[model samples]
Target: MADAPQEIEALIDMMARLPGLGPRSARRAVLHLIARRGQLLAPLAQAMQAVAETARECLNCGNIATADICPICASEARANGELCVVEDVADLWAMERAGVFRGRYHVLGGTLSALDSIGPEELRIPRLLDRIEAENITEVILALNATVDGQTTAHYIADALEGRVRVSSLAQGVPVGGELDYLDDGTITAALRARKTL
Candidate 1:
């Protein structure tokens, strides 16, 4: 890397910082991209630029979008009185990919973590509470990860909305400590179908 051109080395360093990519993998990816600049690299660069400029978090659900509200939030058909609460936008996308949920979603941004000083205020808990009555929500499904923090956050939310609405959680299909983004579509569907009251 020290011998490589400064610009190329900088690109490799940035790529290396990406999740699942190390220095070696980034170096290989850079070389591959350079070799196919026209077919892959150029298009990838353009797409990245476009998203960087246009991507915004949906104000209603915290989902990634180009406008104030995401398509799902804007759609009247999605208002089924059920709201699936996920820890992050990735989890919401995973649920959408499964195509088992017909209602709306609420992204909490992250779970509660005492070590990290993350509390209900750090997440979208206040907004979620407001949405329950604003949307006439009947059920709130906790689709958070199976980690300790995730369960803690779920319990906190359940307690907060104890009498306001019904609260439930995904069933046994999810493995302990497993994240929603890594689950298979079938497993996600089964979990949703077998969700239990919190």
Candidate 2:
């Protein structure tokens, strides 16, 4: 097969760098887009440009927003005195997609990493504390990821707000469809510890 032009090859290279897309997939996608340039490629380019210009982080939380504050932060109904702490905007989006939690969110952007030299100051920890008091937060639900750095950050936050407000963490355990045999030792232990009596 003949090689794509330099510009098309560059687009393919950039698309391949996107998550879940390899070179073959990106090349196929580029071909598909080029085949329907007016329908898909032009609109996709416009959308990307729009997002690049308007997308920004919320001033209060780290969640993505086109405005200064996210809709969740602006909505009074979400001010239920409960704050859900998360590691990243993606995690906050995941919780919203589940529709299980009805509260405000605080995105930490990242967790503590001694190796990477990340600390509480690097994240939105200070802002989190400010919101806890300013928003009259009654409880802080630690919804951080199940990673070593995540847990360390959770512990640090828990200690910081120990006497000020109620602190709790999401229960870690096996997934609904997970099998005991498929679970790792750490997951199995966490599942057993988090088990509730019927």
Candidate 3:
């Protein structure tokens, strides 16, 4: 790196810090970007700058957006009286990817954790309660992860919304078409506990 151009080396160093990228890959990527500077690198830099300037979290749901409210919240059709609460925006995006859920979403940013000192205030819980009444929500689905923290958060939310709206969770299972033998013990147990009649 000593003999390399300072700007190129700096770029490689920064790229290497990105997830799943290492020094070798970063160096290769830098070289490729430099080779295609006119076609790719310049546009990529401009796009990054634009996003950095405009990207912000949605005021209502905590989802990343260019504006205060995201497109989902602004849409009329999405206000279907069902709100799916998730631990992160990533989970919200995953739900959208599946394309089954037609209702709106609420991103908690993260689950409540005593160790990290994260409480309801830190997680947009109050905003969620406000939305429940303001949006005429009839059901609140807890789509949080299966982790202990996720479950605790779900239970807390259920208690908070008790007598206000119907609360439910994603059914426990081996995933669609997944074999029981491939699942972990806890998953098997949850599936058994949540069994339904055919």
Candidate 4:
């Protein structure tokens, strides 16, 4: 690093600031990119530049998109009256990856956190309520994480839409193919509570 040019060192430092990356990992990544400048570095730089210029949140669902509305919201087939509410775009993407859900999604941006001063207004709770009527939503499936904050947010949403529409939550439990020995007590309890008859 001492012998590296200032520009290279700066790039490494910037990369280090990325989530899950440290100075050592960023340095190694920078070295790898430099070694594959034409094959990877240039293309990656171009892609990042393009996304930086065009990336914008979907006006309706808060999904990342270049246009005003994301493709999911734009698709008529996705307006199935079943809206899946997630905490972030990452969770929305994860649901999409599963390919089981066909309805649209609502990104809350974050959960309700009293300590952090994040409330319904801070998230997209109001927008979600508006979307329910506007999109003719019949059910809202809370797909928030299993964290305490997530459950708090879910309960808040459920209470808010109690009479307006049907509100449900994603079942929490053991993962598929998970061993009982590896599961925690809370997970085991949740799995038992959510058990369905075959």
TM-score each candidate. Answer: 0.87, 0.94, 0.93, 0.96
Per-residue lDDT of model 1, residues 1-198, tens digit only = 489999999999999999999999999999999999999999999999999999999999999999999999999999999999999988988998999999999999999999999999999999999999999999999999977899899999999999989999987577779899999887798789878899
lDDT of 4 at 197: 97
Alpha-carbon runs more than 4 Å astray in model 4: none
As a whole number from 0 to 100, the lDDT of residue 162 in candidate 4 is: 92
Error of 4 at 156 (Å): 0.5
- Model 3, C-alpha of 103: deviation from truth (Å): 1.2
Q: What is the lDDT of residue 66 in candidate 4?
A: 97
177, model 2: CA deviation in Å? 1.8
TM-score of model number 3: 0.93
Model 4's alpha-carbon lDDT is 0.95
Cα lDDT tens digits, model 4, 1-198, are: 588999999999999999999999999999999999999999999999999999999999999999999999999999999999999999999999999999999999999999999989999999999999899999999999999999999999999999999988887888989999999999999889889999
Off by over 4 Å in 2: none
Residue-by-residue lDDT tens digits, candidate 2, 1-198: 247798998999999999999999999999999999999999999999999999999999989999999999999999999999999989998999999999999999999999999998999999999998899999999999898998999999999999999999998899899999988999999888888999
Off by over 4 Å in 3: none
Deviation (Å) of 104 in candidate 1: 0.3
Candidate lDDT (C-alpha), each: 0.95, 0.95, 0.94, 0.95
lDDT, model 1, position 133: 92
Clashes of 4: 0
